[model samples]
Each structure stands twice: as structure tokens, then as C-alpha cells.
Target: MTLDERAARRRYATVSALFWLPLGLSIAPLVLLLTERGMAMTAVAGFFAAHSLTTAALELPTGGLSDVIGRRNVLAAAGLLNLAALTLLGLGTTPVLLGLGMALMGAARALSSGPAEAWYVDTVHAHAGPDAELRTGLARGATATDAALAVGTLTGGALPWLIGLAPELGARLGEATSGLVLPLSVPLLLGAAVEIAFVSYALSALPEPPRPPTPLRHVLRDVPATVAGGLRLGGRDALVRRVLVSAGAAGSALATAELLTPGRAADLTGAPESGAVLFAALACAGFACAAVGAHLAPLTARRTGGGERAIAASLTTSAAGLLLLGVTTALPGAFALALAAVGYGLVYLGLGATGPNENDLLHRRVSSTGRATALSVQSLALQLTAALTGLIVTVLPPGPLPWSLAGAALLAGALLWARGGSESRPYAIPDATGGPDATAERRPGHGRPLGGRTGARE
Candidate 1:
């Protein structure tokens, strides 16, 4: 059965929207409350720092798990973990419990990140064939995350007032987002419920595609080789490396904002609650801008002839935005916030456009049965980059550090722009021609006789 590209892609998009809505809802208020409850200035640094550590630890292993078991299982497990984390977070307010909660969230995020795209690709590839649509859909799926974030943020912000009005109407569920009794916790519980619902949706709505019954043990053992190969592949393909590196740098810069913004806002606002206002504005603005920017993806791709160069441009623009944001004392902070909001907006769109190209690069090089393994390897790189970005932001001074991160990220973009297609132009897999024996025509996972589907499992 050929994969119906649009149908499967829509499912993947739904997956992103459903999975991320709860994530944003839970995250926004929880971070605010956690800071108020126990995040001393010192502990504040550790929050994003710990995210990096937890992210790195879980990333590759979960990716590998998807290859062996299935992406569906990985996503389901992530949702279940989110539910548990939010539950623990709501029930406990102590430092240790909060740390556990944060760690759980990080792990779930890392696990859910890459495997979903790989699964969607496999499904799409199985049914129809590879083309630009798969790439576009993959990226749009990610951008849809910003939309979900916006909707969830607005909903969370409004939920408390809507619930409190029940007093006049004589209703009972209680105010969820109101500062009255920690509306922060309410979002988490609600978000977890949404994710569980999404899990059920996935189970009932999406049918699993056939896959090789590769032994779990052999797949586990091959993870190291797979990772090494993926990195090497990045090195070998300039465009893929450019896209990955540029995206990573841009990602790091954004993570830096996420790392420092709350603390910065607290200093400026003199009220912890005010930070949530700024945070929501930045998040919602970024989301709105990103959605609009995603529509320009095809244009960016057309200009660059690939996503890597476009991603580079995004990083450079982000650097400029961060630099502008750094001197908020002079710009009066609001303007700086506006820049960052718009900056992140474009950043998400740029990455979204380029995401498919990089993934397609890998899929083109590998056979069908080996796509998951190869994808896991790439996921590891992306996650590790994000982890590093978070860690760097945690350690650096909150004010100018974002500027520095953005600048460094711009350097990555510059390098990619300079490198161009000299290397990438070669081995450039043409878009797959729809035909029988898709496997017969495609490249092997590792380009080794031993890298065949059966050999990979062993």
C-alpha cells in the first residue's frame, strides 16, 4: 500500500499541534511558578542548564528506541511521561520534586523531538514516494507547533478569568490560570489531559505502516555506528551540514532567550507575575510571526536552492535581533522584546523550511528499512546542539550573552553560505521517481554491504 502523502502528512501535523499545545500550556505557567516557589537567582541558572543535561542524556537513546520499537511507541511514551511529570509537579512544590519535574519534561521533549518526523517520512515514503511535499509538510508540522503554542498560551492566560466568572454563574471547576491559588499548576494538569487525548487519537486514527522486524538488540548495538555515520554524513554533505549547523546555532540562540528572559523580566518588572506577561507576549508574537514566515518557506528555498542557506540567513538575522535585544536598557526593553518576538518568529519559519531538506538528504542516502536508524543519528546531533545551547545560556551573563550566542550562530551561517554546493551538488539524490522496487533503487543506509536492513539488525 502506497502512503498517501497528504493524509499521512496531515496526521503528522495533527500530532505536532496536539502534542505541543499541552506542552506550551504546561510550560508557560509552570516555569513562572517554579521561579517564584524556589528559583533563587542561583537556581535560575541551573534550570536551563539542567534542561541541557537531561536533553542530551535522553535524546539518542530515545531515537534508537524509535528505530527498534517504533516512533508511535516513542511518542506515546513521551505523552505518558508528560502526564506523570505534570502530576508530580502539581502535587509537589519542593526543590527536589520541581527538579524531577523539570527533568521529566526535558526527557519527554528530547524523546519526542525527531522520531516523529522520521516516522512520518517512512509512512509517506511507503505509500507514495519522496518529493518536495514531504519536506514542506515536515517543516510545516514544526511551525504548527508555534501556532499551537500561541493558542495554548492565550487559552491558559484567559482560562483563570473565565473560570473565576463562574461565581456569578454558580459553576464549580475553579479558576485555572488566576494567580489566586497557583493557576500555573492548572495548565499542567490540563495540558497532560490534552496529550493523553492525543495519544488516544494517534492510537485510533493512524494505522501503523509495515516495517522490518529487526531485532531490538542488534539495533541497539548499531546505534553508535549510526550516530558516527550521521555526523560523517553531515560532514560529507555541505548542504546538510550547513542546515544542521545553522539550525543548531539558531536553536541555541532561541534557547538562550528562553534561558535568560524570565530572570531578566523579573529584574525589570519587580514582579514575578510580570515575567509571565512578557513571556506570553514574546511567545505569542513569535508564534504568530512564525506561522506567517512559514508561508514564505518556498520562496526562501527557491532563492537558496536549498534550506541550508536559508537557515543561515535566519541565524544571521537572529544575531542582529539578539544584539538589538541586548541593549534594552537603552531601547527601553519593550522594543527589544518586540525584536526578539519577531526574530524568533522568522527563526522558526526559516528552520521549518530547511528541516525537510536535511532529513531528505539522509533519507536519500539510506534504504527504507534503515531510515529510522539514520534518522535517530541525526536527531542525536540536533538534540545535542540544543542541549549545548541551553547550557551555554545558563552559564553566560543574562544580558549580553544572547547577543554573543547570536553572533556565534551567525558565524555558522556565514560558513554555510561560503561553503555553497561544491560538495553537496555531488551525490545529490534526485527526487525519487514513483515506481516499483523503491527499495531496489534507493541507496543503502551506511552504503556498506553489511549496512543492509538484515545486517543492521544483526
Candidate 2:
């Protein structure tokens, strides 16, 4: 790799780490915090659904916005939005206010989704040429993201308990604030501070590539065309369509794990506060496992004979983990908690492994101009399916059933890429003559080769 390419990779990994850390800090305790504020489980589900719905509604638009405006600008905007949203989440007591906060958070998530990665891809391709290797850098960024989450989850989980230990401090702070301040809110407020850092860093660290100048009117006119073109790719390209479906299945698996795991942790611990700590530890462990899986992706792909096959195997492993979680719901004591933790960790590991492999394929199918939009489309599918899955799981009685259903869905998704043959090889776009083409073929002889040149046109 060139020096410029190495610098770009470092920047990408830094952005990935920064982007995920605050979110990890907030995620482990969010449900418990809301419930502590007097929300019932159903109400909590509604809040989650609201967040998902908002993200889904805005995903495509924000993706196009990134393509229209500069990626750095859109990322900065997302960080600013997250600052407001986290503040509201930390301070608000009423459901309406909190719901608004959740909606804003979703908007932030949508805006942030593809810009950083898009910037990295665009930058690397510009510096290193289209056929430059991408998987190694991409995988490194993924590992960095998971590592941030692991650290943040561990610290966030412990913050509330640490705060509670200082009775005199807590009492004085409580009195000064008229009891609005609480131990549980500290981590979220800290997360808000992190957003400030994120916004500043994004503006300073990410450079925008030169493109055709887009005025407000031009953006308004052209963004829809870009979005439509991106949407059309899913139907026009068989590989992109399958990738979308796989994203949806992955979303379902994620929704099931996030929704049910905290409750299970609480049940094991017999208290919400303790549950937060336990869940945080579990989340940290899961993210650690995810990092390992992401780091091992290249090797896994080579061993499995292709990226598609690796994805299939990873998804199947995730399904089995979910199945284990479902089946062990009735087990007693520490054993069950241990089993659940393993299951949870495995799911994250599988997801970590699956993501880069799938994205590498998707990147091969689209041009740079539409890359962010294509990623948004994939995210839209995931969020939409997750929102639906959340609703369905909410009404079902807690047990093995919801998890089993999720596992089944993941298994079905795996089957989409399970077939062995030339299809498992790195995908090549058809040539103008409509014959087999090798212009953008993956590096020869490896099913899941890392760092091959990207074929997407600008």
C-alpha cells in the first residue's frame, strides 16, 4: 500500500472507533434507564420502534444527502444531532420528550450510517487506484469499531454503580438538581460530551473529495434521481438483491438479541441495576468476540473457499447461537447465564464476520457515486425488518419461541448464498459484449481475498 493509502486506512479506523464508542456506552443501559423512568416493557418497545421507524424513513434520503453534500459535512451534522439527542435522553423524564429524543437519535444514526466508510472507500480508491486492496483496511476498521464498543460498554456499565457508591456526593447532587439527576443518567450525559468530540474530530479529520458542485436546487433535483438509481440496482443486479435480503435477515437476528438479552440478564441477577452491570460485561465480551471474528475474516474466507461461503457459514453459526439461547431459556442459575452469554457472544462474532464479506460483494456491484446510497438501502432493509421483528417479539410471551423464529430466519438467509459453484467466486460485472468479464474480478484463487482493487466507478 502507498503511504497515502495507509494514512487513509488509519483515518478510517479512527472514525469508525469514534462513531461507535458513544453508542456502545449508551446501548447496554438504555432499556433499564427507560424502565427506571417508569416506562413499561411495551412502552419501551414503542420507543425502540419509533427510533427504528425514523431511521428507516430517513436512511435513503440521508445517504443521498451525503452523496450530494460532502461526506464530512453530513457526518458532522450527524454528530451534532447525536449531541442533542443524547442530552434529551439523559435529562428528559416525560415519554413525549424521550420519544422525540429517540426519533432524533434515529435520524442521527441514519445520517451517520455510510458517510465515513464511503469517505474511506472514495479516498483509498482515489489514492491507490480502483484495483487497490480494500478488505484488509475495511476489516481493520471493523475491528476498531468493535474494540471501541467493548471498552465503552465495560465503562458505561460500571458508571452507574460507581456513582451510587458515593452516597454523600449523590445526595448533594440530588438535592441541587431537585432529584432530576440520577446515577443511571450519568453515562448518557457523558455520551453527550463524547458527541461534541466526535463532531469536532469529524470536521477536522475527514477531507472531502472533489465532485461536481451541488447547489441547493441541484441537490433537491438530483438526489432523488440518485436514490432512484440506487434503488433500481437492487432489482437490476441479482447479487445486490441477495445482499439486501441478507441484511434484512441479519437485522432480525440483531433485534431479537438486543430486545431479549437484557431481560434475561435481569432475570439472572434479580435486579435491574445488577442486570445493567451483567449485560455490560456480556456486551463487552460479545464485542470482543466480534473483533476477533472481524480480524479473522480474511482467513475464514480463504478456508471457506469464498466470501459467499464464509458469509453462509457465519450466518449459520449465528443461527445456532440464537437457537441455543432459545432452548436454554428454561435452564436454572449461573449455568443459564453462562450459556446465554456464550450464545450472545457467538451471534455478535458471526455478525462481525458476515458484514465485511457482504459489503465487499456489494461494493463490487456499484459505482462510487452510488456506494453510500447502496449501503443505505441495505441499512434500510435491516432497520425495517428489525422494527417489524421488534413489534412481533413484543407481543409474544418470553421464551424460546421468538429466538427460535429469529434463528430460523437467519438460517433461511444463509441458504441464499449456501450453494457451491462459480457463484461463490468473486463477482464480476458483465462486459459490454454480455460475455464473462474480469475487469473487476477479485484477486485470483481465493474465495474471500482481502484488499483487492475496487471496481466501482466514480
Candidate 3:
């Protein structure tokens, strides 16, 4: 790689780690925290749905906003929103306040989703050309993200426990904060601090390539068109369509795991506090597994001779993990807990492996102009499906059924790529302007069939 390419990769990885760490810190204890604050399971599910719904509503617009206004600005806005959201989450006692916090978080999630990765791709493409080997760099970034999550989750999980160990400190903190401070709130407050750091780092470190200054009217007009164009890609391009479907399935699978796993931990441990600890350990392990899988993505793609096969294999692995979790839900004692942990880790691993390969394929399909928008479209599918899944799982009896349904969805998604031939082959995508015959200008490797390493089109 060239010096510029290497630098871009490093920056990408660094930004990825920073962006995800705060989220990692809050994931394990969020449900537990909500429950402690008097939310029923259905209420928690509703909050989750609200978050996902908000994200879905904003995904395309923010994606277009980033593409037009620049990634740095959009990312900075996301960090700021997160700071406010986390603060509200840490301090707010009422359901209304909590719901508002969740909404802000959702907006933050939407704004943050595609910009950084888009910036990385655009930077590397500018320096190294269109067909640059994206998987290796993308894998490294994915690994860094999961690594941050692993470390942050373990620390976040343990923070509450450590606080409890110091009763006087805990009491003083509660008293100082007027009874708002608690073990669960500590990680979120820390996450807010991290967001401050994130904003500072982003402003100072993230450089943007110059774009023609867009007028407010132009931005308003162009963003909607860009969003429309992005949505069209799913309908117009065969591979893009399949990728969107796969993203949806993956979302459902993730929703199932996220909704069920913490409760499962609580069941095994028999208390919310103990469950938080167990969930933290499990989340840490899962993130570690995800990191391993991300680091192994390029190797897996190479071994399988193409990205498509690797994606299918990863999806199948994820489905099997869900199946395992479902089947073992009824097991007795320690064995069930152990199996659940393994299953959880496996699902994360599969997702980790799948992400880079899938995005690598996606990156080849669209130009830098529409890259972030395309990614947002993918995220939209994921979040929408996840929101629906969250609602569905809430209504279903808590057992293997929800998990089995998720596994089945994942299995169907796996088959989409596994069927091979027409489905796995990329097709030319229309440009963001919706110009006719745009496909005629398809990049050399853009819509190639995946097969041998020579056709890997890295």
C-alpha cells in the first residue's frame, strides 16, 4: 500500500474505535437500567422500537446530509447528540425523559452510521484508485471497532460492581447527584465523557476532501433526490437488493439476541445486578469473538475464493448459532448458560465476518458520491426489520420460538447468496442523478461475477 493509503487505514481504524467505544459501554446494562427504572419488558421493547424507528426515519436523510455537507460535520453532530442523549439517560428518572433520551440516541445513531466508513472508502479510493483492496483495511477497521467494544463492555460491566464495593462512594455519589447517581448510571455518564472526547477528536483529526459549496436550497433539494436514488439501487441492482435483504435478516437475528440474551443472563444468575455482570462478561466475550471473526474476514474470503461464498458461510454460521441458542434455552443449569454464551459469541462472530465482506461487495457497486447514501439504505433495511422484530419478539412467549424464527430468517438470507449464479453476481447500479445508460459506465470490477480469486475483484 502507498503511504497515503496506510495513513487512511490507520485513521479509519482509529475513528471506528472511538465511535463505537461509547456504545459498547452502554449496551450491556441498558436494558437492566431501564428495568430498574420501572419499565416492563414490553415497555423496554417499545423503547427499543422507538430508537430503531427514529433511526430508520432519519437514516436516509442523514446519509444524504453527510454526502452533501461532508462526513466530518455529520459525525461531529452525532457525537454532540450522543453527549446530550447519554446525559439524559444518566440523569432522567421518568419514562418520558428516558424515551426522549432514546430518541436522541436514535438520531445520533442515524447520523453516525455511514459517514466514517464512507469517508474511509472515499479517502482510500482517492489515493489508491477504485479497485483498491478494501477488505483488508475494512477488516482491520472492523477488528478495531469490536476490540473497543470488547474492552469497553468489560469495563462498563465491572464499573457498577466496583462502585457497589465502595458503599460510601456510591452513597456520596448518589447524594451529590441528588439520588440520580447509581451503579447503572456510571457507565452512561462515562460514555458521555467519551462523547466529549469523540467530538474533540473528530473536529481536530478528521480531514475532509473539498466539495463545491452547496447552497441551503440545493442541499434541501439534492438530499431527497440522493435518498431516492439510494433507495432505487436496491430495486435496480440485483446484488444490492440481495444485500439489503440479507441486512434485514441480520437485523432480525441481532434484535432477537439483544432482546433475549440479557434476560437469559438474569435467569441464570437470578438477580438483575448479577445478570448485569454475567451479561457484561458475555458481551465482552461476544465482542472478542466478533473481533476474531473480523480479523479473519479477509482470510476467510480468500479461502472461500470469493466474498459471496464467505458471506453465505458466515450467515449460515450465524443461523446455526441462533439455532443452538434456541435449542439450548431449555437445558438445565450451568450447561445451558455455557451453551448460551457460546451461541451468543458465535452469532457475533458470524456478523463480524459478514460485515466486511458484505461492505466490500457494496463498495464495489457504487461510486464515492453515493457511497454513504447506499450504506444508509442498507442500515435502513436493518433497522426497520429490527424494529419490527423487537415488537414481534415482545408479543411472543419468551422461549425458543423467537430465536427459532430469527434463525429461520437468517437461514433464508444465507440461502440467498448460497443459491449462487444470478443472485450472487453484481449488476450495474444507476448513478445518484438517475441518469439513463449510467450502467454503461460501470467500473471495471463493479458488476463482475464472483468466483475464483482472479474474479474476487478486491
Candidate 4:
């Protein structure tokens, strides 16, 4: 890789880590705080349910906006809005306030999602290469996000008590705004710093791909047609479609588990009051392990071969973890939770690693305007799946819900990804068979051999 390619990848990775940090940071304490503050648990679930639906509702429009207006602009707006939402969460003690806060957060999330990826891809594409380097940065950044969530959750959970135990570390935090502001304030600060970094990176590192800047008036006229084209093509593009559907199903299951795990653990351990804290810590630990697993993705691929095999293996492991959780009668369920988390993180790596190439393939079938719309359809579908999964969780015994998702992901996901045809590309770090030869060669993922070095060779 050229110096520019390497630098762009690094910049993109940093952006990924920063963007994901807020999601987990907010999630770690959200449930416990909401419930403790007198909101019903079911209502809490409703907040996310609404959140998922609203995000899907907005995904297409925002994605189009990115195409029309430029990703950097949309992303900066997302960051500012995100900070506003987090601040609202800190002050909220009622359902309406909480709901509003969550709604804003959802809006921020929808705005932030695709544009960042698009920006990175466009940047890499402009810099005398293909989409591969961009994808590598994405995966690396995703790993960083996972690690940050792990750190945030662990720290957030323990900080209050630690403050009590050792006053020095948190003395000023307590003095300035008491404990509440400190916990939430930190995430906002990190988010702002990262958001500025993203904007700066966009300005400095990413070269403008030779493509013409889109005109806003023209984009308004064109987006509908572009969206229609993406829908029609995505319907026929079996690989992309399958991946979309699979991600949604897996998302629903993951959502269910995310919603329930802390509650279940809280009940079992008599930590209902502080369950969020413990859950965050444990969840982060599991997520951290998963990030390690993600770092190992290239190595895993070398050993497993390309295609749906490694993904299938991850799903099966998830199923086993789910089953263990369902059947276990005691604290061993903690182990089950860990297993489920491990499975969850790897599944993300397997699937997310595939996302850019899928986009590249879809891009071949459509224009830049159409690319944004196609991405939107995928996002819309995933959100729909998550909302539906809410209904499933409302009924299923919590433990069984995770198992159900695991089984569906393994059995159904495999069938879906494999439905299109045999992969013509080498199932390696950068799967390039689906796009043009030049694009494939420029792809820059580090290999993750099963039980071997990753990026270490670099």
C-alpha cells in the first residue's frame, strides 16, 4: 500500500472507533438508569423499538442527503445532534423526556451510519486506488469501537464505587457536577473530539475522487429514481439481498439478547439496582473478547477458507451459547452470557467485513446516487427486523430468545448467503470477485489466519 493509502486507512479506522463509542457508552447505562428512574422496563424496550423504526424511516433520506450534500457535512451534524441527545439523557427522568432523548439519539445514529462509510470509500477511491484499503480501515475502526465499548462499559460501571473508594480520581468530577454529569459528560467529550477528528481527516487525508460534486437541486430530482433502481437491483442481487436479510434477522436476535441479558443477570445476582453497571462491565468484557476475535478475523479466514463457512461456525457457536444460557439453572449462565457475547462480536466481524465489498458490487450495478439508496434499503430492512424482534422478546422467555436468534442466524443465514452462487473470488481478507478486477486488487485487508498473526505481518 502507498503512504496515502495507509494514512487514509488509519484515518478511517479512527473515525470508526469514535463513532461507535457513543452507541455502547450510552447503551451501557441506559437501561438501568431508565428503569431506576421509574420508567417501566417494557416502556424502555418501547423506546428502542421506536428508535429502530424511526431510524429505518429516516435512513433513506439521510443517506440521500449524504450523496447530495457530502458525507462530511452530514456526519458533523450527526455529531452535534448526538451531543445534544446525550445531554438530554442526563437530565431526563420521565418517559416523555427519555423518549425524546432516545429519538434524537436515533436520528443522530441514522444520520451518522452510511455517510461515514461512503466518505471513506470515496476518499480511498479518489486516492489512486480501489475500495479495499477503505474496507480495511473500516474493519480496524470497528475493532477499535468494540474495544472502546469494552473500556467504557467497564469504567462506567465501576467508576461510581471507585470514586467512593478512591476519592482522588473522581474528586473533581464529584465536585464539579456530582457523579451523574461525570459519567455522561465523558462520552460527550469523547464524541466531540472524535467528531472533530473525523471532520479534520475528511479535510486533510482523503483526496476527492474524480467524481463530480453532486448538485443539491439535481439530487432532489434524482434520488427517488435512484432509490427505485437500487430496490429493483437489490431484489435481483442475491448476495446483497441475502446479506441484508441475514443481518436483520441476526440483529433482531442480538437486540433481544442485548435487552434481556442485564435484566436476567440482575435478577439472578440481586443486583437489580446496579444491574446496568454490572451488565455493562460484563457486556464490555464479552465485547472486548469479541473485538479480539475481530482482530483475528483475517487469520480465521485463512484457515476456514472463504465464503459462509466461518460465519456459519460463529453462528453455531452462538447457538450453543444460547442453548447453554437457556438450560443453565445457575451462575454458569454468566459463562453462557460470555459465550453469547463472544459469538455476537465475531458474527459482526464476519458480516461487517463483507459489507464494503457488497457495496462495491451494488455500486457496479448503480450510480453514486443509487448506491446511497441501496444502502438505505439494507438499513431499512435491518431496522424492520429489529422492531419485529421486539415482539418476539416481549413473549419469549429471555434465555430462549438468544437461542432462537442463534439458530435462525446459523441455519437461515447460511442458506441466504449461499443462495446466490459459489463465490468466484478467493475467500480471503479482501473478497474481490464480486467487483471489477482493479477494485479487487486495490482492496487492502490484513489476513486473519485461524490461530495466527493478524496485521502482524504488516
State the lDDT of candidate 1 residue by residue for 348-429, as single tens digits. Answer: 4444444544554556555443355455555566666666777666776556655566656756665666434432343443
- Top lDDT hit: 3
The runs of at least 3 residues in candidate 4 whose Cα sits more than 4 Å from the true structure, single-residue gaps closed, are 1-3, 32-50, 91-98, 128-135, 164-216, 267-278, 329-369, 398-402, 418-421, 425-458
Q: Candidate 1's error at 252, in angstroms? A: 2.6
| Ranking according to TM-score, highest score first | 3, 2, 1, 4
In angstroms, give how far residue 143 of model 4 lies from its true place: 1.4
Q: How many backbone clashes does candidate 3 have?
A: 0
Residue range 81-114, candidate 3, lDDT tens digits: 9999888888888888888889999999999988
Candidate 4 global CA lDDT score: 0.57
Candidate 1 deviant stretches above 4 angstroms: 35-51, 93-97, 161-182, 212-232, 235-238, 263-275, 327-329, 333-357, 360-362, 366-383, 386-405, 418-458
- Candidates arranged by lDDT, highest first: 3, 2, 1, 4
What ranges in model 3 sit over 4 Å off? Answer: 1-3, 31-47, 94-96, 266-276, 397-399, 419-429, 435-437, 440-458
Q: Considering every candidate listed, which one attains the maximal TM-score?
A: 3
lDDT of 3: 0.83
Clashes of 2: 5
Q: Is candidate 1 or 4 superior in lDDT?
A: 1
**True-vs-predicted CA distance for residue 340, candidate 2, Å:** 2.5
